[model samples]
Target: MPSSNDSRVERARIVASFGRQFYVRTLDAPGPDRVAVTRGKRTDFCVGDEVTIRLIGADQAVIERGLSRRSELIRSDRYNVKRLAANVDQAAIVIASDPRFSEELLLRMLLACATAEIPALILANKSDLATAWAAIAPRLQVYRDLGYPVIELAARDHPQETRAALSRYLTGHNTILLGESGMGKSTLVNTLVPGAALATREISAALCAGRHTTTFSKWFDLPSETAPSGAIVDSPGFQTFGLAHVSDSQRVHAMPEYTELIGGCRFHNCSHIQEPGCAIRAALESGAIDPIRYLLFSRLAGRD
Candidate 1:
């Protein structure tokens, strides 16, 4: 709650937002005591959004306007698109062993992050599961060779290591934590930020998927001493992440591995499916490009 004399407009960043209410950290006081604010009927806000708010009453305020957003990460399905986070500098894509792992989803997520122009770091959780780790190691290496950083972490077994590694990646950046349910995203969040006690649930044996634990996106500032200022936003787990907003051209350019060969394709507008003299296929056959990634690209381009 605000003091009786707190009626004024101020700049703030949205730390947590859901429905009509938002938890905003004031520019002057960036800490735990965020003012709870509501939006006007037409006002829209997302986690990491910078906005101006006017305090109208004690502990309450209304968002007056949203500042410009540098970038917006969105997930879409056939039905609709939803904004996951805004103004994030990097994306932390978390994958785990429980409930099984999907390479297709991983590729899609990386592509989405690439298209959004946000660098992504792959956090392979549950490395303590030896059998699962062994099976996923080769695929993980493919991503690593493509120049994306891959950090192996056993969140439960090595909390300190996980926190330290994550802190290094998040330093000086606003990173969004992305993953499917049951992948230990919440658990990682709890480890990274001790004070953030996000709820966690076990994977369902029958369904082979994790139950939804997070219902909304929330941001937490990281503890800083020698490192640059950093923060992370934990988003709710989802079964699917769509890239309907990304164009075919953007998708092709997003993959750094394919960049060198893109210009050599047969057609200037090569779909890369059945086109003759396609350089992408040539590279895949010659072992220059990873076959699995090519397949994933084909699927995304509707060529599969």
Candidate 2:
């Protein structure tokens, strides 16, 4: 804790955020993390944000303002835009073989990452479930063909293999884990960061919420031996991920397979939905593009 009279503005990184309350670690000095709050109703801050703060007490501070973000992941519906995290180097979209993951939600997350210009990889968890793994293997191959690295691992059943497979991607990067509920993301986080459960408990105590009430995002520093110079953010699992913030043109260009064929449409402003001379439709018909992905595009573009 800093002296109350020392009113110097210092740099800090937000480690946890629960609604308007935040926990920030000082980047400028060695001290315990301070409880932080904004001066007004500005609740746009998210975990992993680098911000400036001024200490008001020994254990609390006021967030002055945020620094420039390197990257930000956001999801939006017609009513609201939710910021997930900021300053993330990459994102890992965790999906499971069992429980039948939604391809629509997965595609929306990928597009959100693409629109944010952040690199993303797919983690096909639950590979130990042989029957389910066999069923989802081919669908996972489609993403691999599109150039997204898809790593298969069983986070709970094979912790060693899971850690080994994710080490290369997690090392030296600030990664955010994105997944729908029951995808083993929490297990993965505990496997990667042994202290994650404890941290979660601490956060729960601080917020006076139940242990299972994951209403906030929390950041964990990776063990040096496992992933030096790296950190991971565990976000609340959600059933829906919207992309109302993404424009129609942005969505089209975000698809890797559609980029090359974007300007080949007859009309310069082709919607790629029903235009007769649309190159995307031609590619879909010729099997150059995955039909599932094409259909997903139509649905996301509100054409379906």
Candidate 3:
């Protein structure tokens, strides 16, 4: 039996969210997660959010308010903003050689991560496909040269090697996994979190939405042997990653190659597209910056 006093408030971290329903694990005690919801139309909560909750019953609570977030990854279009996760230490952008992952989407995700002040790494999955790997290896090098760590692994073909290669990165940090469909993101999750499949099934059942695991975000704790203090949040796979929420200046500064050349531009408000003496364009012409990236930037900046 619980009391009717205000002493029922407890700190909790959101572990899963689907639609307006959220599942929060109490930080004050070790117990099963409680289904939580905001008072009114407050639906801003996302997986990995730490919030204060008031227990209304044995298996449910009401989210009182959210704590300050250290970092948040978001994607947006002209109409809506989609929050991916919060309080994550870093992000792992998984891509595969087969099915031809979109570099544009990858860039968008990197930009979002950069704007959110979250470090990102590229996981080049499907390394066992030698022919496809050969074709994309050079492109992967481009990202590596930009100072992002790129780890190659075949999630499906070599589970042990994949786990070993990613263990260091996953240790002691809360990582958010993002990737498009067919990139082995799910396979990697199962490899790192052995019980992830069963957990997903349980989450789906708890949410009363069968077969909706891939459409929602959920958190999984890493095994103690693998990562004592680490956890991973698996987000739904999507083809498009928008950045309409990011301002132009933020986007420009987010690019590693353009950071050093920013002040070199002639005009203080140079858009870097048609502006003469633009340091970015100059670098592009001088072979100092990758042409493909520059083209992508131009397109994103609406100059192409």
CA lDDT of each prediction against the hidden true structure: 0.79, 0.88, 0.88
lDDT of 1 by residue, 157-267 (tens): 788888777767888998899998878887887777766772222212222434557776778777784136888888887877788887888888988898898899979
Q: Give me the displacement of residue 157 in model 2, in angstroms.
A: 1.7
The TM-score, computed over Cα atoms with residue i paired to residue i, of candidate 2 is: 0.94
Best by TM-score: 2
Candidate 3 lDDT, 127-223, residue by residue in tens: 8898998999999999989999999998887888887888899999999999897787778888889888887888777667656338788888899
Worst 10 residues of 1 by lDDT: 198-207
Ranking of candidates on TM-score, top first: 2, 3, 1
Clash tally, candidates in order: 2, 0, 0
lDDT tens digits, residue span 144-237, model 2: 9999999988899788888888888899999999988888777888999987888788878867887763667888888888888899998888
TM-scores for all candidates: the values are: 0.89, 0.94, 0.93
